[model samples]
Target: MTSFITPCDSLADVRSAIDQIDAMLVDLLAERGRYVREAARFKRNQAEVAAPDRVKQVIDKALAHALESGAEPEVVEAVYRSMVAAFIQIESRQHQALQARQAPDAGTMSGCICA
Candidate 1:
């Protein structure tokens, strides 16, 4: 990762930093995706994947952290909302797949057996 304090005089330098930061963000998102998949194993149903209370809690935390980090709360909220939405979709798919594997002939189960 590039140092945040590194000075940039030219457009290319700024672009380089942005590219590096974007790469890091991709890596972090991938890691987060893995955790979301793991969490799917613990989720009981589709409602759990779209847990509203948990979403609010996460957004609130992200807002506070954004303020502390000198970033716009609105921007942080938007980004988190998008990320959470995507993760919820992923989790839902993973949950369905796991459920299908657990009960192939039983249609669908209501709750997670692993829970």
Candidate 2:
């Protein structure tokens, strides 16, 4: 749950609060990154790494949570879409790496990831 903060009385205070929140966001993203790395192990190829249905499900859940938390849905949707896209790329790389390690002489997985 998000913690409540007091109203800012000055620009410096506002910036400080934003910085703190950003730091927290970075920390959260790092934790999420670790999980993404682990998720790569379960995926067999780029297609599974970039599962469009799973992406939609994640966005759907995020949008619902945005409504529940009084967040702007448009901003939430935009951020999630971009973040998910980037994570898909990262996960794709990890998936390729894992596949290579499992069969080093076989080479990278073939075919593009398609929905």
Candidate 3:
């Protein structure tokens, strides 16, 4: 669970808080993207993305953290799944790009990029 500081007494304070939140979100998402790339490499190599053991580990850890932070487990799970789905979509796009780059036929290259 991410905790944010918000001083909503003034418009300036609200704007400042929002700016800070945007920065934090960017930083966190960038970090998560790095992990997504690493995971994509594994996925490209034909390794499983939805391993039950790994998913269980994540859910258990998230649940524990959410409990400690007074956050709802279901809310955390929903947010996490949404973020993960976005990452996976990015990963799939990257994999497609790599495949297009490696294609032996030049016609496929233009088709992929144009599409």
Candidate 4:
């Protein structure tokens, strides 16, 4: 279960709470990465993978969410920026590999008779 701002009695309690949140974060990030990789399949090239405008939109949305959730905008922006950058790189590489893998197959059926 997700926890909110709960008062801790000692450092151990605080550490435990943070550990739980970290675990949740790791799971969520992995799920997000899966979607990011899937997104590579839809992209045609590295430029589409990067999509700077989409990056700005995502960060803007994150900032808005931070403000609504009472989180520090700067901190949220910083984390999101780093996360988005890393995802972009991942997507770019995935896109290149996808293109390379498809390139060889795209011409393989050229000599086949189409009934």
Show model 1 residue runs off by greater than 4 Å. Answer: 1-4, 106-115
Candidate 3 stretches with Cα past 4 Å from truth are: 1-8, 11-15, 44-47, 50-52, 99-115
- Backbone clash count for every predicted candidate, in the order shown: 0, 0, 0, 0
- Supply candidate 1's per-residue lDDT for 38: 98
Score every model by TM-score. 0.86, 0.86, 0.62, 0.86
lDDT of 4: 0.90
Better model by lDDT, 3 or 4? 4
In candidate 2, stretches whose alpha carbon ends up further than 4 angstroms from where it belongs are 1-3, 104-115
Query: Per-residue lDDT for 31 in model 1?
Result: 100
Error of model 3, residue 2, in angstroms? 10
- State the local distance difference test value for candidate 3: 0.73
For every candidate, C-alpha RMSD to the true structure in Å: 6.9, 8.4, 7.3, 3.9
Candidate 2 per-residue C-alpha lDDT over 1-115 given as tens digits, one digit per residue, 9 for 90 to 100:
5657879999999999999999999999888888998999998778889899999999999999999888899999999999899888888889888887787464545664867
Clashing pairs in 2: none
Candidate 2 RMSD to the real structure: 8.4
Write candidate 1's Cα lDDT for 48-70 as tens digits: 88899999999999998887887
lDDT of 4 by residue, 39-85 (tens): 99998778889899999999999998887888899999999999999
